[model samples]
Target: MAEALNNLVQLMDPYLLQILVNIGIAIILALGLNIITGITGQLSLGHAAFMSVGAFASAIITIRFNIPFGLNLLLSGLMAAIVGAAIGFPILRLTGDYLAICTLGFAEIVKVVFLNMDITNKALGLTVPTPKSPIPMPIYVWLVAIIAIIFSSFMKDSRFGRALKAIRDDEIAAEAMGINITRYKIESFALGAFMAGVGGGLYAHFINYINPSDFGFLKSVDMLSMVVLGGLGSIAGTVVGASILAAAPEFLRFMSEYRMLVYGGLLVFLMVFRPNGLLGGVNFTDLVLRSLGRKPAIAEVREKQT
Candidate 1:
């Protein structure tokens, strides 16, 4: 299968292939953030911190233990999930701006830690061995992304997912209904961090380098933008949103000096006109069920945000 993919990739333009890789990574990152902020209403500003953890973990594993690519990805995610749960336990109790601030601060601390760490070579960064496989990086990335999307779809209809939505909609009401708010919130954080970690591993392998600065505040914001632009709580919307925003920079490269200015302006324009996001609250799971002649398990969350 990998040999076949590699053969197909050989025929594609490198630039276009790179763009596809970027889009796939962006989709994974956006989906991770959506699990936390969009579905669970946990405003995390340090998601990139988890990504950094994954990047370094995966790189170190390859360098030290020579772990296989597939196993390394899972280990990286597991490491990040552990970190996320540790962080989320006490911090998940906070809401709104407070939670955001704490998460941001945590992200900064992570950046600083990596900057001073010995294994990471401090500011010099670490070189990662790119996976030597018949399967192209983009194929691996998109396969994981598709798996993530499928997992999300299943979670959306599960009893656990309903409990999460309840908490998101009304915390006090959800608690009154006997929901274990803290546990569920922490679970969401862990799951989201796992996805981000896997994405970081893919990114590290693809770029062939890992830097502490690479997964910084701006990167987290970029992921958030994808989730927000696509519509919160909408998996399919996130895929579309991430693809457009991820590819936009490459497409606007001709603008050069004015590229970022144009990108920023476009984002501002989108927010002003479609604040809820392009497909805010439009869940693909609901659409699928409807198409299959089945009633959706829960009412779709409305996009209205006052």
Candidate 2:
């Protein structure tokens, strides 16, 4: 099956294939950030730090331990989650800009650690082992992305998800209602970090090389941009936002050096027009259903409208 998929993928345009691959990875990253910042209303500025941890961890495991690819991915995510929980425990007490600053500091600390570590080859980075298997990279990337989406969707509707949402809306009120704010926040951080780590693992395999520089402040900003553009707490919006932003650089390549300028300007323009994001507080599912001339459940409609 992997071999056949690879053969089929090879027939497509390489550039387009690369873009799709990027979008898949971006979806994973964005969804992870969505859980922390979007759904939980935590302002995090160091998400790329988790990705860096995952990338390096996964690469090392593959290079030295020669573990199965699936195990490598799981271990990488677990490593990142563990780190997030550790960091989150001390800093979760801080709120608003203070929380953001601490997270940013944590990210910088992580980057510096990787940059100076001998096991990671210091500034030189690590080379991941190419999979001997014939599985198409996009297949692996998109499959994980689909699972993330489903997981996120389920989380949004579950009791656990509601508790997170409540905290996002009002921490004090949520605490009043018996939700353990600190514990929930830490869990959110861990969950988000796990996803980011998995994404980094996939990314390390796809690119086959990774250095500390790749996971920097800019990378974190890019992840935040996707979630914000897509719409906080909306999985559908994250998918759309991640796809557009992931593909924009390629589409804007014709502009050469001015592409980044255009990209920044585009984001500013969008924010001005849609301050809440493209689908903020809007029910994308209902919109799609309405477009198809089908009706969503009354309860869902009411819930979204509020």
Please report the TM-score between candidate 1 and the true structure. Answer: 0.94
TM-score of 2: 0.94
Model 1 per-residue lDDT tens digits across residues 1-306: 777888888899999999999999889888989989988998989999999999999889888886578999999999999999999999999999999999999999999999999999999999998776566888899899889888987886689888888999999999999999999999999999999999999999999998999888999999999999998888888988999999999999998999999999998999999998988878788778899997665543332331
Find the 10 residues in a row with the least total lDDT in model 1: 297-306
Off by over 4 Å in 2: 284-306
RMSD of each predicted structure = 3.9, 2.4
The C-alpha stretches of model 1 lying farther than 4 A from their native spots are: 289-306
